[model samples]
Target: MSEPPASDLTARARLRMAALRLFAERGFEATSTRAIAAEADVSHALLRHHFGSKDGLRRAVDDDALSAFDRILAEFDAPATRQGLLATFGTVTARLFGADELRRNYLRRSLLEGGAASGELFTRLLNGTRARLAMLSEGGDVETGAIPDSEAESDRLWEPYQVLFLMLGPMLLEPVMRHTLADPVFAPEALHDRSAANQRLLTRGLRAAPGDTREP
Candidate 1:
């Protein structure tokens, strides 16, 4: 397909595209505004005009990555049944694995290269997930027994973030996880199946059975 004309693109789009390429290649900390500007073929003033600062640009990148995931939550306000929750959860998990290359690399770097640079982004992302979970619970998405009485409300809140991290294994572990699973164990086309499996377990709650020793 032919590409869209440059005239059809916004300054923010250009800057974001430049930032994604530069950050993925150079890491967020190492990439400078000047370098991004040069890559985008735009003046530094334009970057400032649109994103305000490097931090602002990085926030935009994270928001762009999360936008799709957030949209699923928005679409199904209450997710009234277990199946609804599972299906929605499945979609969210799939997005993490199937995210666009730029988003995948940017988030991988932000999460693995953790420091002050990514702290704000992860915090914001987690908090948003928690808020959405709260909404779901309030809307009756969660049924009793889905979570045990012994677990604190705080622990329940972190469940979605835990799932988020697990689904990101492809980026965090790279070839190691792929090699460990191998093609036979987890076929390349089984990404959605893997995501569905995660949702099934996650939606089932964290209560341990008699021999369970997984909890810290």
Candidate 2:
């Protein structure tokens, strides 16, 4: 048998990554500890040693990802200007959909395939998004006259819940969207372009005219 090549990634990290990927693809109940160990190229004993148990491993992934999410939120500063709003939104959006496919997939599946866990995840996401928007609103970054308001604009505005639903739904259905949309707009490989496109739309209301009374 050939020896495995040397690599910098630790066994524990590999296990966590593998667990994340498998859990995202197969959901937590469907994924097995044995599969995680095999995917990580480590012994099952090692998995037990590092994580204590499969449930513990799941918690670890959640803890690690949430910790990173906290840092991402920390990057969102109270905006001093409309430009600042755009910059902050762009940064947060890109980070949410960053290279961490495991976190992204887990989040998407949790939303799409609802369960008890999905409710918890949604609560966390909704609170975080609301806080982010509130901070921006207070800081005078959320509205910049880019989109003229409706008569009841302030009262009729969809809250952060609606915003998150809009953001996460498409993300969870990306694979379907990629083929179904059949446009470069849905290109999985071109997230930069996609985010840029989103930025533009967000600045202006979806209405053909800024004063259009249609709901967004």
Candidate 3:
């Protein structure tokens, strides 16, 4: 068999990146392969040759995002103090929220739509998040004590999801949140500041209590 041509590979990568950005912005249904090709400055035929279909392109984007998130989560070290936990969460929040518009758009699509593809991506995200939180709890770094085993047995364990959501949900909801906050003292900068403050509060609230040694 012949090796794949370098130009073809480059075109495929470009297509994937373009699709990711567009999907993040316009969502899957709204974005077409032709639009992705246009965004990448490639041809529709080239996109189809590389990705097979729009669903295939979305899967690639999902894989790319999930891999990137895993790398970010892996970098998180367990925080040793309540303040440290707050700072760690703040750092994570900032990084995720700071993602380029395209990535944010793709995430929104996954959340708003529910089907095999979106469901798989959502499951991967949730699992990755929980695993990272479990690492924090295991290391005894999170200020919050080990979540009680009985409570954690629920399918929708709240703490991990709560933490992850607080970090990301605001960005997803920014448009609506911004409109809702359009009162006195509700400037965009102030909203961001308040969001940051809320992250700190959540970090502090989630920390293990002093003298609690139970493991998650």
Candidate 4:
């Protein structure tokens, strides 16, 4: 297949970004094609030429946002020990969420809105978490007996969900968190601190030491 012209790629990116911003701020149901086009400073006809419609633009945005998670998961090409996996996940999560406010907000909105696209994104994250946990378990990084009975009874079924929540809970509750804490949670300093704290929790949970009784 022939690649699109450079101008076409640029326009498509602009339109997708515009749509992402609007969707995050005003929501999919309320954002309009013309409004997105105007935000992009492109004509409505140009947006249609690139993305077909508002829904198409949204799908593009979702794909773009989800692609980051895909890249993060791909970083685990080789199985890592429990501490190694936690460190990698913490670094990537901080980098991903701290880099772009708009992208972060878009993801938060998508997850909170709950739709087909949102479900797909959440499923992808959850599946990725499970895969990483499996890698640790299979690599003998996680001692099965060390896991608490509450988590191990169901074969550690809820571990993935817990990990996912620790990773994304701030994004989902940013507004309330900011208000309550009186700080921008995604700010670089705060994000780094949050990542470190989350990694500590994971480290405690996945520690394989025989006598360490630290709670995660």
Whole-model lDDT per candidate? 0.66, 0.66, 0.67, 0.72
lDDT of 1 by residue, 55-168 (tens): 899888777767855765576655655444545655654554464555666777787787886787777767777787677878774664456666756667556666456545
Candidate with best TM-score: 1
TM-score of each: 0.74, 0.68, 0.70, 0.73
Q: Ranking by lDDT, best first?
A: 4, 3, 2, 1
Instruction: Give the clashing residue pairs of candidate 4, or none.
Output: none
Per-residue lDDT of candidate 3, residues 1-216 (tens digit): 122443665888888878877887777888988899998889999888988999999889888877767776677787765345534654565465455445665676677777788778777877877777777778874454455767556623765566556656665676677566654223446546765566455444546576544433
TM-score of 1: 0.74
Worst 10 residues of 2 by lDDT: 1-10
> Would you list the clashing residue pairs of candidate 2?
none
> lDDT value for candidate 2?
0.66
Cα distance off (Å), candidate 1, residue 152 = 4.9
Q: Which stretches of candidate 2 lie over 4 Å from their true place?
A: 1-6, 79-91, 94-98, 137-158, 182-203, 209-216
- In model 1, pairs of residues that clash are none
Per-residue CA lDDT of model 2 for 4-105, tens digit only, reads 332657899888888878988898888999999999999999999999999889778877666666667667666554434544555465556654556777
Winner on lDDT (3 vs 4): 4
| Clash tally, candidates in order | 0, 0, 7, 0
- Candidates arranged by TM-score, highest first: 1, 4, 3, 2
RMSD of 4: 5.6
